[model samples]
Target: MIHENPPLLTRIRPWVFVFDGPLAVGLALLVGISLVTMYSAASDYDGRMFDHVRNLSLAFVVMWAAACLPLPWMMRSAVPLYLLGVALLIAVALFGDIAKGARRWLDLGVTRIQPSELMKIAMPLMLAWWFQNREGVRRWYDFAIATVLLLVPVLLIARQPDLGTALLVSAAGLYVIFFAGLPWKVIAGGIVAGLAALPLLWSVMHDYQKHRVMMLLDPTSDPLGKGFHIIQSTIAVGSGGIWGKGWMEGTQAHLEFVPERTTDFVFAVFAEEFGLVGNGVLLLVYLLVIGRGLVIAASGASVFARLLAGAITLIFFTYAFVNMGMVTGVLPVVGVPLPLMSYGGTAMVTLGLGLGLLMSISRQRRLVQS
Candidate 1:
């Protein structure tokens, strides 16, 4: 008699998948709505940005499809995917398409892809896979090796002069290390050491990067230059105080008060037109997303699955927090786009890979249950 594999299409923790499916779909819808409403205003109805929205939505669909794969299969494949991602990042550094003074995209004939974005998903996956296989073998050398793995891509991305994405990517890698349950003392010591090295790190930043930090401190210093983006974003956000100015009625976006209105500054447009209630509701949905990811993380099926899910969850959280923080004048402008809602390809693909890992984990847990 031949044994049949459990139906891949069938319920793997039926309720778990359903809960995830709705949140994922809802996030996409909300993002899609934001694109339509914001682009109309930001583009002054030119509607050229519609194609960007369409492409991004398509990317989200791709992400959802990846998420449907079995978790163990994802775990098994994480290393190769990660290495490929790293190789791409390296390739971009040497022969990349430069725009706006930074070479961030690699032209693969049909697509101009950002490899750094791939690293965001790949780093956590790599670390999780590394830590998962380690199991009961806890050694400083293992930690060192994992740190090196994290550092390799981080340094390469940093060389691309993409400090923001590099920071976010590093955080994703660190999530795996932290969740591997390393000692508190070690974590604390690393923080202290890092703080001490800030001085040295600051000295090495590109001239423009320092200017951005300076601009963050005093945006009025160059109100018409680097400071312009922050100034406009703040006005947009503050203008939408309570119930907001309402949808297409946002003067900030409509009047061109915000730069990068469709991408990094989308939150400002969102806050301006939707106000506090909209912001709160959006945040609630994001929290639910995080909560679902956490449930997957804490389930403890395997270190690889748990670590990958945790890193991806934290990546989502970081994207939201960092983007909002920059928009509201609470954080430095590091060019981190908002998750889902931001109009960008690299970011969407990164999110997709992470979601795919989550779905894979959920599926594995389901199979084990059956």
Candidate 2:
């Protein structure tokens, strides 16, 4: 009997068949929603929509590439990746470009890059690796060392005054620390210390940062100045009520009242056009993704995989909550983009990497089972 070769498509497909099924489905759903919503948010339908599609395509490609890496490879890469991230951050601090008054980008004569975005992935990976190395001997000193590792990047990002990315990186690292069996008393003490340090934090904040806090408390103070974003976004959200003004019918967005409608304020556009019912559905999708990520974390085959997965999952929640809260005027405007919904390349790629890591962990679990 002649042995028939497997089909070409099947042979070619195995290399790309690495995603977690439910997570992939969830991401697809979000992307579909984003396309429809981007059409409405974009003033130039062809240009803006095309750019968004291009970024998303790149993001998906990155996600797939990330998913193909074995969990051990990822763990092994953590320290080197983190060290590179920190080195790049130091480079940014020394000779970075200034954009909108923030020194957060590095000009390498070829392209401009933000090193802080790397920490969004690197911080957790490094922390997970650290904890994994000390699996049986985790002690208070280990937690302290982890805190130092987490803080170095955070403080550097903050000095760059890219507070939004700093907050995200900090949260990602903290999640890892928490998952590594951090004490409840330590958590409570940290919360208290954070609260007590508010005065000092305020004193050191830049004028714009202070203004954002003030605006959150009273958006009407400036109306058309720094408060414009919060005021307009809140109007768009409130006017949508239950049923919304319908797709592409949001007066705030179409009339140019909603600033940054395609970026940080994309959630406002979504809320205005889709309304409460639409918001409910969108939130349900997010919840599904988060839930699936948590499941992957819980099912991970190793401590490193588990901690990294859990941290990345919670980071998703942080992005959504902070973006939505800022847009709704409940929180300060922190320039955080809505995950998978915003029109930006950096954030999209970063998030894609995160999802890809989750898929890798999930893939490892399945492989072990089989």
Candidate 3:
């Protein structure tokens, strides 16, 4: 028998089915916004805009490849990835290149890699795998062991003075443990203990870290120095008013008042150009992505899938929340970039890996059900 070509959509359905619809829409919107904002934010820096686009394109590919992997393959690979990340962390501690007073990068003969970024995905993967093996028989000690696993890479990253990344990694692993039936009383007790340890935490903080906290409390104390970032970013955010200054018309970014306008503080550029209404729309898009992720997590076909999906979802939440909080001057600047919106290869890749895992879990669930 001879057949004519299939309908256009029918021919493409297999490719389209690889990604979750809502998640893809949300990511596309954010990426579009990132491109627009980058055009304005990086206008003064030749080639920066092209670099941003390249990074984002690479991220998209990473996400696509990740989504194509089987869940069983992901589970089988978890321990090896986790072990590799930890070993890399140890190597970083011993011989990583120092940049801006932080030893967070390992210089290979060709390219430098940030081992801590690997931990961002590996931590949650390892924890989810651990809990999946325990399944219904989990106990308090399981959590204790998991906590220890979480702390190793966290302490290593923190030793590099990369508090922002360490915090993100910690949150990722904790989300897995929490979703694996961690007790509420234990959570409450941990919070209480954390609060009680504030004094000791303060005593051990690096000088710059302490300064950041102080600046958060009062930016004017050192307005021209350590506080310049907060002050200028907050101005950019507030000056946008209800409707924003209009795209590419933002003075703070174009005038060079905002620091890191294309990277960590890109939100300030966005707020300045798009205004309050724009911020609301951006937040709504993020919420849509987050909501879709949680839905995927809830429908996960196995315990491992559920925990990994949930942790990865909340990790996105953490990225956005921390980045916006610091830009608005409500929190200390910890160098957390806005997810999918910031201009950085490492973060984009890490986030892409996360998005891929979410899509994979979601696709797997649909496959099993159908």
Report each candidate's C-alpha RMSD, comma-separated, in the order given.
3.2, 1.6, 2.2
Those runs of model 2 whose alpha carbons end farther than 4 Å from true positions after fitting are: 1-13
Q: What is the number of residue pairs that collide in model 3?
A: 1
Clashes of 2: 0
Q: Quote the positional error of residue 286 for candidate 2 in Å.
A: 0.2
Worst 10 residues of 2 by lDDT: 42-51
RMSD of 1: 3.2
The CA lDDT of each predicted structure is 0.81, 0.94, 0.95
**Please, what are the lDDT tens digits per residue for candidate 3 over residues 219-282?**
9999999999999999999999999999999999999999999999999999998999999999
Candidate 3, pairs of clashing residues: 244-275
For each candidate, what TM-score against the reference? 0.90, 0.97, 0.96
lDDT score for candidate 1 against the true structure: 0.81
Q: Give one digit per residue, the lDDT tens place, for model 2 in 117-235.
A: 99999999999999999998688999999999999999999999989999999999999999999999999999999999999999999999999999999999999899999999999
Among residues 3 or more apart in sequence or in different chains, the pairs in candidate 1 whose N, CA or C atoms overlap within 3 Å are 67-356, 71-360
Candidate with top lDDT is: 3
